[model samples]
Target chain A: MAYLDHAATTPMLPAALDAYATAARAIGNPSSLHAAGRSARRMVEESRERIAAVIGARPSEVIFTGGGTEADNLATKGVFWARRDADPGRRRVVVSAVEHHAVLDAVGWLGRHEGAEVTYLPVDGTGRVDPAGFAELVRAHGDETAVVSVQWANNEVGTVQPIAELAALAAGAGIPFHTDAVQAVGQVPVDFAGSGVAALTLTGHKLGGPVGVGALVLGRDVACTPLLHGGGQERDVRSGTLDTPGVVAFAVAVETTVRAREQYAERVAALRDELVRRVLAAVPDAIHNGDAEHRLPGNAHFSFPGCEGDALLLLLDAKGIYCSTGSACSAGVAQPSHVLLAMGADDARARSSLRFSLGHDSTEADLDALLAALPGAVERARRAGAWKTPR
Target chain B: MSGGVDSAVAAARAKDAGHDVTGVHLALARNPQTYRTGARGCCTLEDSRDARRAADVIGIPFYVWDMADEFHASVVDDFVDEYAAGRTPNPCLRCNEKIKFAAVLDRAVALGFDAVVTGHHARLGADGLLRRSVDLAKDQSYVLAVLTRAQLDRAVFPLGDSTKERVRAEAAERGLAVADKPDSHDICFIADGDTRGFLEGRLGSAPGDIVDGRTGARLGTHNGAYGYTIGQRKGLNLRVPAEDGRPRYVLSITPVTNTVTVGPREDLEVDTVTATRPIWHEASASVRCDVQLRAHGEVVPASVTVAAGELTARLETPARGVAAGQAIVAYRPDPGGDIVLGSATITAGTRESAHA
Candidate 1:
């Protein structure tokens, strides 16, 4: 059976797997002072240097984390808490509407339980946040703003936000800016220095690395309070005995994915473009979501009028074609997506939307299976209820 | 199909009859995820999952229909409006009438299923007559009185011939998860068995007067009238004791005037009731049948007269506290027990509060 749910989780690349296997066979804790430990510590630093070179960051800036979620949480809450503590008046957090739940939820928790006011900067239909709108919000709140977080590219609809423009605005105000670049790393050009964001989040798994290992790039000037306090690892921000094997594998995966970035993007984008074209031609009313030009090469999202996304997902699953309704985190809840709602979509359109993401193993055959299964599935789903007339 | 035990068994029995039977569970939850049964609900996610598991055990396919928006718009909203209008509405009757037999059945028929099935403890004869199930303790036809002929045409009940014990035994024999699942007894939506709390949360507490029926004197401050239904005895939080220090029952709820009337237990009995949304299984025949006002109420001998799509039932013995919103199911004696004819909503009640 074809596994099309790569956005949910991708198979590890051969290089990453080799790195993990090699590290897993090796002995010693990087923190220990013994010879074995010194060897492990050297391997970790070397892997860190390789990843730093690819992302255009210094080795000291990369703080290793558990995964994308932990990295996003640290970037959001850690930055907000640190800024708020330094200036008691900094009680506001600005976030883009299309942010992942890892950031959206962390910011929401700060607003709800920690007494920090949160303002969501609206996105256009393509899910891109206007830098001017974000600048206006920061200008209104000024120094009272704790932090601003926006994804470099949306994980679902894949609209690549103008991170450089947004960073410049936040930099002028001296408010720390963080961007979740998990989906953007291998799909587009993401240079830490060029982007000008203080902190950036990247996960290994999205780029064909092992799960449970990621890094948060923090500029030398930025100060972030740790969410989890323990043995003061990762420069006193994230504390845990580091997984040496996972780190090596993650770094290996990052370097390999980055090196093959241009070719892979072209191949995946061709497949995604065909998928969008075939889906639209077959299901005429299918509305493609996200930025037509600036979206990630592998992301294709569409809203089919008068059909529930769950129904479509199940039908596709029945034919052994695996995709997703939206973000996998909020799949079970039968509510229209909050991201779609914030993008000015009504409940019906939000409920009707589906996300089909391509990755390392994606092929033309996978798109053919989806194209063949969609028309019948949408028709049957529409027949099951009194469909809402399309807007 | 009625959602009682017998009809559920009947549906399963038919499925076991080697026909292409597809077992279905309707999603009546306004929000199925948060759908709770009052304190002990049966339409819960756990229950729906259990029902799906049962279908899986039977080697059949199951699906959860998104009937939330419709359930809220139809049954739940109707129930709130009924209470707000100073009338008691049988939510079970509304659910069965709309959700199970009509909405569920409608969807089932569209899915190309031969018929919709339930566990209703009522039987349909070869001549298409509605008869009570053999089980005397678990007859649910009282709540299923609103099923129309069109709905009944595609309806099937499996447990109509067996008692509740036999039904459980069959489910146990089949190793269904619901084999030992306790029967639900209260309103499903009220979590934590707090009806008043559910009402208060949904309908904000608008403090009002609890007036004495006798002297027309203002008794004490009470929460909104919607919190109290007819025949309720406790949670009145009354200030003064009755003349004889007897427990008071809620005699009426007036939403317009926003008043709750409380009186002695004697004010609870009623003799006559008028019903709207009447449905009959037999083609307009005069038949001597038993009537039950509530789910657990004893079958009372009654004379039912129909006029202008309304059913007026005059019981042989005056039943006390016949609230306006309860279901009135008609039953006829058969070898099994009483077969259900149809049901209606209690539109009016004759109270013994004439002295007031």
Candidate 2:
């Protein structure tokens, strides 16, 4: 089977798997102080340091959580509560419209129940947030704003944002900025300290590690409240028993992926470009989405006119080719991609789009498999067209 | 699949028959929590999960097809409109006609599937004629009669030959989790089974007088004319007793006049049922047949005539409480009246004595 949906979650690296298995055989919680516990604790701290060194953060700044969603929730809610507690007047949150549901829903909850006035900054047609528009918002409501969030890269369209510039604007206004860098760490160069963001979120599974483990990289001076309150772990910002095996596996994956990112990016980006060229040639009306120059290396998203993405996905699945529609499904109902809608596509165009993301193991043979199956699938899906309620 | 014993067993049987069967559960509810409150309704999240689990045990791929838009436009809206017109419409018939057969079947065929296999207790014979299930208590041929020959040609109902008890036994034997799940009854979309309250929320209160049919005297006041159905004997709430001191049943509801007419129960009997928009498997100028007025209503012998897309059935023995908006389904003459001849939407029903 050809797996082209790596952006959703890539396969685990072999070294990371070995690390997880080796750690799993050992026993004792990192929180315990006995000899076995100290051994486990050493492994956890070393993993934290390794992740910190690679991401350009201090060891204390890397607070491990359950996963990317948890890290995003911790950063968004935690930073908002901390800022609001510091100054009661700080009740406004500024976020980009193209953020994944992890940050979007967390901020949405705060707005719905916590009396937060949210300002959703719009993106350009390429799904990139403009620093100038954000600068204007900061100048207008700088004092009242508790936090600012803009993702480093969009998961759906793979459009990389101007995070350093946006972070500077938020810093100038004295508001903490957070970026959900879950999709960026191993694909592009991510330097936590150099990016100048107060906090950032990264997960393990998206990179080549085990699931259910991730870290929130917060600056030393960033005062953030805790989302979880038990066991006083991870410097009191996150409080769960450390997942030692997952953490070790995550660190191993991070180090290996980051070290080889330059070469990996070149190889996958070449394959992705070939895919985009061939698909457009095969189906002339198909529109490639996202900024050509500022996209993730392995990401290629397209909109096939007059076709429902779900129908195409199913047809391709029958041919042993797997991909995604890059939209959230609620109770099996395919919602139009908010990222595509934010990029100025209509509802039909948003629903018609599909995402094909190559990964570490992806090769030309996988692309050939997709190209072979895509034309027939598109024809069948076009025949199905959009579902119209018969009058 | 409907996440019930019959559908689960049907899917298993189809797979056992060596067809490439893929189970599909229609996500008819837009918001499932609001649609089905608990285990009482179909298309709930729990129902979808149950369907998926059954598919896993049967070892087939399963998908939930979101048909919420089509369902609302065709079934739900038509239901409210029919009531506003003072008619008691069977939403299940409308759902089968528009959604399960038309929209879903079209999509399935477009996706290269040979046919749609549903759990309805109706037989589609190899000769392409629709027939009643062997189990009369659970026969759904009346609801499915609205489907055209084209739709029925691509439809498969595997549970038609077996009784509900046998289907449940098969499900249990096959290790399906929903073997004992309660058969979904009433309207699946009406979560609480309060049809009046549901209609009242949509078409708000329009107070009208309840008048005696013979005397033309006002007997009581009703919140809305749509709330009363023909032949309803309960909840009339009449302030005055009848002259003969017998209970009065609802005879007619006139939405334009905003009035409900009540009289003796015998007045509910109608000898002729005139229906429009006939869908026929076998059409003729006239046919002697048996007609069903509503779901689970008695089958009565009738002589039916077809003309200009309308059908009029004159019952040999008059039937009681036949309402407009209900389907008039004709079947073959009955030593065994199993074959479905045709169906149409009832527009009017008149007593023979009134016409005479």
Candidate 3:
């Protein structure tokens, strides 16, 4: 089987697996003061320092959580609550429209339940948030805006945002900015300190570690409220018993992937470009989505004019080629990609798109398998035309 | 699969028979949260999970085809409209005709699948004729009688030979999780089983008079004429008692007049039923057959004639509660009455005594 959906989740690296197994054999909670506790604490501290060093953050700033979603919620909701509590005037949140549900839904909850007024910063046709638009929004409601969030890279289309410029605007306005860098750390160059963002989110599974482990990198001065309250841990901002094995595995995967990122990106990006080229050649009407230049190296997205992405994905699945529609499904019914819709595509175009993300393990053979099955799947799906019922 | 034991077993049996089977659950409810709250209906999230698990155990590819919009437009809307027109419609029959066989089948065939396999307790004889299930107690051929020959040709039912008990036993033997799940009863879409409340929500109360058929005296007031069905004997709450002190049954509902006429139970009997929009598996000018008027209603011997796209059937013995908008499905006269010959939508029914 050819698995081209690494952006969803990739397989764990052998090194990370070994680190997890080794840590699992150890006993005691890091909070317990006994010898076993101290040993566990040492392991946890070492893993924190390794992750901090690799991601260009100080050891004290790295706050471990259950996973990327928790980190994102902690960053979005935590920061919003903290800012609003500090000043009653700060009741607005500014975020890009194309953020993943992890960030979008959190901010949406803030808007609905909390009194946070949200301003969705629109992206261009290629899914990039323009810096000028951010500047205008800041110039208008800078004082009321509690936080600004734009992802480092979109998971669906792979369009890298102007995070540095957006962060600079937020800083000038004296507002805290957060970026969901879960899809960027292992796929691109992510330096927490260099990016100038107040907080960043990264998960382990997406970069070849175990699931259910991730971290939030926060600036020293950023005051954030805690989402979880129990057993005061992680500098009193996040409270929970740390998963020692998971933290060790996550750190090992982060270090290993970051060290090999440059070479890995080049190899996978070349394969992705070829896959895109051959796919477009085979199906002439297929449209490639996302920024041509400012995209993640291993990401390739396309829209087949008259095809339903779900039907095409199933057809490909039948042929042993796995990919994604890159959209949320409610009760197995595909909802049009909000990212694509935000990029100015119509509902049909949004529903017609598919995402194929290559990983460190991708090869020419995988791309060959996809190309062999794609043309037939597209033709059959177009013929099906079951996306919209004729009245 | 419907996330029930029968469909799950049907999927397994089809796979066991060496046909490439794909399990599919239909998302029929617009808002699925309102459906099957505690496993009494289909299309709920729990049911979807059950179906997915069953598919996993059966070892086949599974998908959920969203037919919510089509179902609302075709079955739900048609049901409300029929009721508004003073007719008692069977929504399950309409769903089988418009959704399962037409909309879903068309899409399946277009997607390269030759047929759709459902768990309806019905059979297709070797001659490709629609037949009642051997398990007569669980027979669904009445509801399925609406399918055309073309639709029936592309449909497969795998649980016709076995009883519901046998199907449940097979499910347990196969280690299926839904072996003990209770069978879904009443209308699946009507969550509380209150058809009156459901209709009232859609067609708001148009207060009307309930009059006695013989005396022409107003007996009571009804909130809406559509809430009362022909042959309904309960919930009348009549203010006046008949001179003979006999219980009254709903005889007719006239929407235009906004009136419901109630009389003795014998007045609800009809010997002649006029129907339209006839769908036939085997068309005939005139034939002696047994006709079923509603989903589980008893069949009566009738002489059925077809002409000008209309069907007129005269029953040998009068049938009570033969409501308009219910399907009149003709079957071969028993001892071989299991074979479905044709079906039509009842437009009107009249008592021979009234004409005499």
TM-score: model 1 vs. ground truth: 0.81
TM-score of each: 0.81, 0.98, 0.97
User: TM-score of each model's B chain?
Assistant: 0.88, 0.96, 0.96
Model 3 chain A — which ten-residue stretch has the worst lDDT? A382-391
For model 1 chain A, where is the 10-residue window of minimal lDDT?
A: A382-391
Error of 3 at A74 (Å): 0.5
Model 2 lDDT tens row, B47-149:
8888889999999877778888889999999999999999999999998888888888888778888888888898886778788988899999999999988
In candidate 2, what are the lDDT values of residues A1-391, reduced to their tens digit? Answer: 9999999999999999999999999997999999999999999999999999999999999999999999999999999999999999999998999999999999999999998998999999999998888999999999999999899999999999999999998998889999999999999999999999999999999999999999999998999999999998899898989999999999999999999999999999999999999999999999999999999999999999989898888889888898999999765668899999988999999989999999999999998999899998899888777455465
Model 2 chain B: ten consecutive residues of lowest lDDT = B33-42
Q: Give the local distance difference test score of model 3.
A: 0.91
Query: Candidate 2: where is the Cα deviation over 4 Å?
Result: B34-39, B333-337, B353-356
| Residue pairs in collision within model 3 | B334-B337
- lDDT of model 2, residue B4: 81
Candidate 3: CAPRI quality band: medium
